[model samples]
Target: MTRTTHDTHPVQGPEDVSGEATTSRWQQVRATGDAGLATAEYAVATVAAVGFAGLLIAILKSDEVRELLLGIIRGALSVG
Candidate 1:
């Protein structure tokens, strides 16, 4: 098949016709399913952060962990 391009009108092939259908399908899929993906991701991250913070707080508040951290800090700071 020969291909020709003109300044006034571009060539339209079968691919061009199906490209619109593909684009519309993609748009519909994203519009229906991915709209709340960001919110869900944010919510998951927030929950994970809160859980990690709570775990840290619990660990820091424990006497054993506090003593261990203090010992490490004191050992690091002490002069040789």
Candidate 2:
């Protein structure tokens, strides 16, 4: 005995009716085009955040900024 298989929706070519083949191809591309978009965005945001944190750290470590912070702390701590 032998079994036969058939495809209910066969692949469409450019010659398909009403440009459906082009539309279908575009839909498929669009569907999968952004599969990693969110991950890529998160990675970019993470990198930007890390860069900003590094900048903040550098600024805070400056002598002038350190002195200003210390002065502010001293003023806050001193009794009037």
TM-score of 2: 0.54
Cα lDDT, all candidates = 0.73, 0.73
Candidate 2 residue 78 Cα shift, in angstroms, is 0.6
As for candidate 1, its clashing pairs are: none
Error of 1 at 75 (Å): 0.6
lDDT per residue as tens, model 1, 1-80: 21346433234555556777657656756665643358779999999999999999999999999999999999999999
Candidate 1: Cα lDDT at 28: 56
lDDT of 1 at 55: 97
In model 2, what is the error at residue 13, expressed in angstroms? 28
Question: Could you give candidate 2's per-residue lDDT for residues 1-80 as a string of tens digits?
Answer: 22223232345544465666668757866765544458779999999999999999999999999999999999999999
Show how many residue pairs clash in every candidate, following the order shown.
0, 0
How many clashing pairs does model 2 include?
A: 0
